[model samples]
Target: MVVALFNLVSALAGCVLLVVAGGDSVGMPNEWLARTPFPSWAWPGLILGVIVGGTQLVALIAQRRRYVLAWGPHAASGLVMMIWIFVEIAPLLVWSPLHGVYFLTELVQTVLAVLALGAWPQPFFARMPRRSRTGVGNTTDTPA
Candidate 1:
C-alpha cells in the first residue's frame, strides 16, 4: 500500500514533467542543463515519466496483484528511483532538499521491499517470540 501511494505520486509527477516543456514551469532553470547533454527538459522529462515512473507503475501493479516474486519489481523500482535521482542530479551538479527527501523515500522503499522478500527469519509480524538464528542476535535455540 505504501509503495503504491508512492508510485502514484511519482507517476503523476513524472507525467507532469513530461508534459511541461520548459524547466521554468517546474521551478528549474534551463542553465542547469548547460553543462549536461540535454538541451532542454524534454529528454529528462521523458526519461523521468517513462523510465522512473513506468518502473514504479510496474512495481505497484505487481504488488497489488500479488504476482509471483512481487517483491522483485518493488526492489527494482526502488533502485530505479535511486538511480534516476543520481543520474538526474549528477549531470546538473545541483542539489536540493527534495533530492534528499526522494532519496530517503526510495531507500525506505527498498528496505521495505527487502523485508517483504522474507530475507530474514520467517514470520516477521508474528505474535510469537523470535528465536535465535545462526550468526544472528542470539545463537541459542531459545526464543528471544
Candidate 2:
C-alpha cells in the first residue's frame, strides 16, 4: 500500500513538474536548474515518474510485488538519480538548504522505496516461500 501510494504521488508530482517547467517556471525555483536557461530537471523527473511510478503503482495494485525488478535495481537506482542532482551537479556539491518541489518529491520516492525493502525484513517486502522436493517450505536448518 505504501509503495503504491508513493508511486502514485511520484507520477502526479512528475506531471506537476512538467507543467510548471513549461507554464509556470516561477512557481518553483531551484538554484541548480535555474543556472541553465532550459528547465532540465523537469524532463528527467517526468521520465522517472512515468517509468518508475507507473510500474510500481501497477504492480502494487495487482499485488505482484516485484520489488527487485520493479524499479530496475530498486533503491540503488533512486539513489543514483538523487546523487546526480544533490551531489555532482548540485551547487557546492552538498545538500541544499532549500530544495525545489521536484527534488523533494523525487527524494520522497527514493526514501519510500528504500524503507519498504529495509523494514521488518518481510511484512512490507514479503516474498513467496520456496518449496523443497519434500513438499515442505525451505528452512534455514538442515536435518542433522
RMSD of each: 5.2, 8.2
lDDT accuracy of residue 4 in candidate 2: 50
Model 1, stretches more than 4 Å misplaced?
Answer: 122-144
Worst 10 residues of 2 by lDDT: 88-97
| TM-scores for candidates 1 onward, in order | 0.78, 0.38
lDDT (CA) per prediction: 0.78, 0.53
Candidate 2 — which residues are off by over 4 angstroms? Answer: 20-26, 30-42, 51-55, 58-144
lDDT digits (tens) for residues 1-144 of candidate 2: 563565457566756665556424634345556554555566656655666565555545444554454543345444544554554344534344334543565566566666655644645555656568898877644432
Top-scoring candidate (TM-score): 1
Q: In model 2, what lDDT does residue 70 have?
A: 55
